[model samples]
Target: MKNALSRGLLLSTAIVGSLSLYSLTTKVAVVTADADNAGLKLPAGFGALVVAETGARARHLAVTPQGNIYVKLNRPNKEGKGILVLHEGPTGKATITGGFGSYGGTGVYANAGYLYATSDEEVFRYKLNSKGEVTNPTQPEKIVTGLINRHQHESKSITLDKEGNIYVNIGAYSNSCQVKDRQKGSLGMPNCPILDSAGGIWQFRADKLNQTYGTGTRYATGLRNVVGLDWNSQTNQLYVMQHGRDQLHDIFPELYDTKQSAELPAECLYALKKGDNAGWPYMYYDNTQHKRMMAPEYGGDGKKVSPGNYIEPAAAYPAHTAPNALLFYTGTMFPEKYRNGAFIAFHGSWNRAPEPQKGYYVVFQPFKDGKPSGDWEVFADNFAGSSEKVATGRADHKPCGLAQGADGSLYVSDDKKGTIYRIVYNKK
Candidate 1:
């Protein structure tokens, strides 16, 4: 009947390589709450909850050093994976302690004690312990893997740098490279040899987990997409945001105007180093003359500009609110004006079509001594449940990943509902 140690643990591949079924047995504290939901709102000492809701498409999050909370879900409807842990208490309650996915696009991180994860091509690591859990999640290793998923900007998103290196964005499956991507003459990719292998951001060597995209190193390039990235230990550099690039009226319909393609390019933010370039297709970033223009496929069209190069943007927004995630608040809960500031998450915008849909939530910006000092707030709103409906940039909840905890609180992720908020600063 199938049970002799489950058929010798499935024909014994050395008992499945000596079994380590992604260890997970956490539950030291429990406290569920969901009297309907619709919560969150901070400052005034701060607080917001709902640590784990449906639990299936939660996106990014990493915390550990014994505060537990790993998240990274997004398999949805066909589900089967791991990494969801949780486990936090000291009164703020949270506990799931079971989940460890890897093998395809979700992005979870944990650093130092090692946990790392990813999958729209590959990256993995596991062997955490000393309370952060996962002592050997089914033995993952593969640090990199063929990463080139042509599914609309693909999802890689990774971070780490303090000398350990390991940045990974790789987006650009065609859009401004057009030539058929957005259709028209479908002509584009002029000098875009796919930027030496997909748009930008590569760097590797976080202990070399299993590297393979030809090994790594191409630290920066014309980036037409970067679902937000981080590493700003007070200016150690390497920040990113860029998502700009969309059909501005189906590629220069005689020079924009669908209401100026909802607002015209701009939606950048950069800091990169080590060979930086930051100009895609040709150049964009012109939030009312902030500068760097010329990008109607390389020819001066929307008011000229761009000549001899690019690289400029420490700020600029309003376009397709799609900035996925970026963090940099050294924690301590909040106030001190939010320490190193820089939240960001915005999974909102359906082209701003004629004027309506705009970024669904999260936004902070306030870096002080390392740059960007103030201007830009709205840290978490109703996540598009309805702020007067324009619907179809869609979102019953769409904030898309950002994490930090180990007392510094704040962990939001919502690949369209599968929630996992947690804000906190309770100071009661």
Candidate 2:
């Protein structure tokens, strides 16, 4: 009888010992960078590292509390996987541990014990374990499905507020809601039928299961396309960067010159509330004039002003900058000046031809008390490799996504090069 009891005690001891070893092996290391940030250019005392060169086209990413990084790919990998889970090693390198989600997508976020991601037509979420890894990677719950994915501007970038609501950008398929889209002589459609289902931000319950388009509410309207958006916890409101309508001079040469087209309508940043409309198709904010001008399709020349009631943009940028990701910094690792400021990833422009393509960098917009306190400045540059590449619109890496790590480091994803860069600040 004594031998039997001794055998059971030894077995339990062996099992516990095995678990301890396993935990040590699985423990993730905190990532840090060298004094000089690899190759990326930044301000003094800031550094970055090309932590992972993910071969997949990384779109948007989310970092968990445990430093686990999940990236949503714009295209499936060679193995037909669309999402990648990365584990950081003690040496500050990250390795792709698992890849799943067959459908390719652009939006990925982690919140409320779930990792929320989006395909062009649906929004899905995976339950996260205590270690911040996906508990069920193979099968995620479809939170929202059957969205309008018409192939043009269909990427559904998403963000969740502190409340239970999740916002998704449903970009308009048509550039200007024209009667004959993109045609030179096309007129703007009256009442703009696309606004009924698209061209806006939609809000849905984050924790709800299997919601359809009918189950969501249109939070804001008249946005042509919004790839960059975030919920600012400081302001307790939603902010979005709208991709202004394109082909201003191509289709309306008589109204606008090539130089004017390249820089006329401003890419706008808007702080939004429910039921807010920024007036697309009818009017566009002119950064030069600092006023909302009537669009050519709406029967207006370049000099004509619109009488339509449209909310003014909180800030405006050069046309076709293509802000793809918006992040409000709330971390203490950076200096106090960075708090509540916004970092925007400009994916670069292709439409500003014959002048010079611009915006292959990230910019910082200062904010105080939820409003723009000062001018925006280029935070990171040289993503295009050289000035010639910027002029010709040839970019080595176009920044697509922005994420904040638990350690207050910034992560930027480049879809063109499938690279992930981690930016950190060290006081001099």
Candidate 3:
């Protein structure tokens, strides 16, 4: 009888020892980083690693608390998969384990035990099991449908507020709401017909099924395009980064020189309220002038002040930078200054011809009392790979999406080469 008891005790001890070894191995792998910081230039004490090479047009991504990463591709792969699932292994790098969702779009969000994703004209949700694995990837419930997709600015970017509401951006098809749409010397369409269905944000129930435009409420208007948005828990408000219109000098050479065109209308960050209008077709925020100037197509030249009724931007950045993702930090891993502040990923600029194209990096905007406090600073750079590449407007990787890990690490996605980078601060 004594020998039997001794044998059982030894078996239990062996099992416990094996588990300890496994746990230690996983901890070491999770904290490790690539030696070169994955060719990214981050702030002091911050390092980066290549999470995975998804090999698709990874537009946006969501990281589960369990470390599972879901990346949304801009288009479906040859296998008809638009979502790639990455699971980090004992090697400190993530491996593409699975993929699902046969359609493509630009947005992906994980909240309330569900994975919400968007196509060009629809939003869908899939239930995630306790392990953060999507249980019904092959059959997702449609939350929204019949959205406008003009093939230009057609990506439907989405975000969810805590109150079970989702907001989707429907971009205006017209460059400046001109009657002829990007044609030089064309006047702006009177009252802008696109405003009735596009060029705005619509709010709908996050959990609802098959909700269309008739069921949703137009939450905001006059936004030319918005690809990045997040719900600010610090202020209980929705914040969005707007991509300002293009072709200032090309269409209106008499009013704007190439230098002015390169730097005229600033990409804007807006804190939204219901019915807020940011004045797209009529006006644009000028960071240099610190004022909203009436759009040339509408009636006034570049110098004319805009109407006071138009909602002003909370902050503005260099024009044509193409702000693609907005994330408000709420983690303690970074310094106290980063808490509740915002990170914006600029996907580089193409409209700054004759001058060097700029802004293929991430910027940190400080926040005080739930509003922007001081000047924004570059947080991560060199995604373009070289200064010559930035000068020639040829970026190797454009930062398009931002996500925060369970450990407060920041993740940025590049659609060009389908690379995912994870940024961590002050690692041991």
Candidate 4:
């Protein structure tokens, strides 16, 4: 009887040992695969690799110090989980290690040993272990909840500052905050009620758990919808890319022609402070005019200028580009030209139909003294698969999020193809 018991214990130990051995072997075999860079075009010194064919609608991503990549999906995977954790093998290849979190979201950021993510209606966080992986997948602390999600521009993008504060973007549901939203010639609301709880960035405590909307402070207001935002540590300021109001011609064809509608309102990048207002619903910045113009909903004829003392954008880009992600590069892997600059991922535009669709690439804006110094130029291109595909709005991949790894490599996430591309500068 004693021998039988000993034999059973020995068999159990062997099973455990074999499982561990298999895990170790698998990790070792995860070498970096050669990513096809044929489709992506870049500058002379930079190259990209398709690290992982994630097969999930990847939105935003966070890279840990230990080199683990955490991706937030716009929708849940087969197991109903929205977060995917990836580990890089010795050969620089990344493989999915685990999946967690139930509700899909558009924001994922890591700071102070915690991985912060947001669903459309709430913000949640998971504690990270020494290896940069989540310690508890099934349980996460709900940092903020009860956010309004009205389906139109409902993505809750997030950013974290060095001072332990988290900023969340609660996009306005209506395009122009019109009286009868989106209706032709609909008058603008004098005082947009959505500004009370939405259409702004809310600041919350990074360490606090289970807080609600009332607990957060409206950091900045009058932003129509901001999907691309980041904290520039160098300037110690918050920066955001505001998606300008759409349908200028459709709403007021008398004031604006189709060509003007496709190109009048410029996508803007604003460097924000605590009480800053970008002047939405009331005014829209026209890069061509070089001034903030009053919207047609506000009784403007496309040539009327705004009277409000609104702040101007740090830099402005072409209209309908749909800038989706912003990152201020602080890494040393790239040349001096790229360091301290801002990288913007344009998710491409659908409204520029009569005209050719544009902005399916990543752009670099040079900065000096914490402000834009030179013209913003395309850093990476050809994500639309081809110029013909771009013109017809049939893009193969759209760059949605940008992240920097510990080794100074840049990572871009595509929601359309569920792919992650890593850009590295091999000039040296």
Which pairs of residues clash in candidate 4, taking residues 3 or more apart in a chain or in different chains? 32-93
Q: Whole-model lDDT, candidate 2?
A: 0.86
Clashing pairs in 2: 37-48
The CA root-mean-square deviation of candidate 2, after full C-alpha superposition on the true structure, stands at: 8.4
Point out where model 3 deviates above 4 Å.
Answer: 1-29
- Give the candidates in order of TM-score, highest first: 3, 2, 4, 1
Compared with the true structure, what per-residue lDDT tens digits does model 3 show for residues 358-380? 99999999999999999999999
Please provide, for model 1 over 1-428, each residue's C-alpha lDDT reduced to its tens digit, 9 standing for 90 to 100. 01011221222344322213222223222222333333644445455667767546777778764557877775623445546777766434567757656444667778777877777777787878766688777777777878888887888888988788778898888868866778754556678777787788898887775676677888888998898799989889889898888766766778886878788787887888877888887777778778888777767588888885567888877888988898988865466787887998888888767677788888988888878876878777776766764255656788888987644567787877767776755342
TM-score of each: 0.37, 0.92, 0.93, 0.91
Return the top candidate by TM-score: 3
Q: Estimate every model's Cα lDDT from 0 to 1.
A: 0.73, 0.86, 0.87, 0.85
Model 4 TM-score, 2 decimals:
0.91
Superposition error at 211 for model 1 (Å): 14
Q: Which regions of candidate 1 fall more than 4 Å away from where they truly are?
A: 1-28, 38-60, 65-87, 90-108, 115-129, 133-167, 170-199, 208-216, 219-223, 228-253, 259-295, 298-346, 350-354, 358-382, 389-428
lDDT of 3 at 405: 72
Worst 10 residues of 1 by lDDT: 1-10
Q: Give the TM-score of candidate 3.
A: 0.93
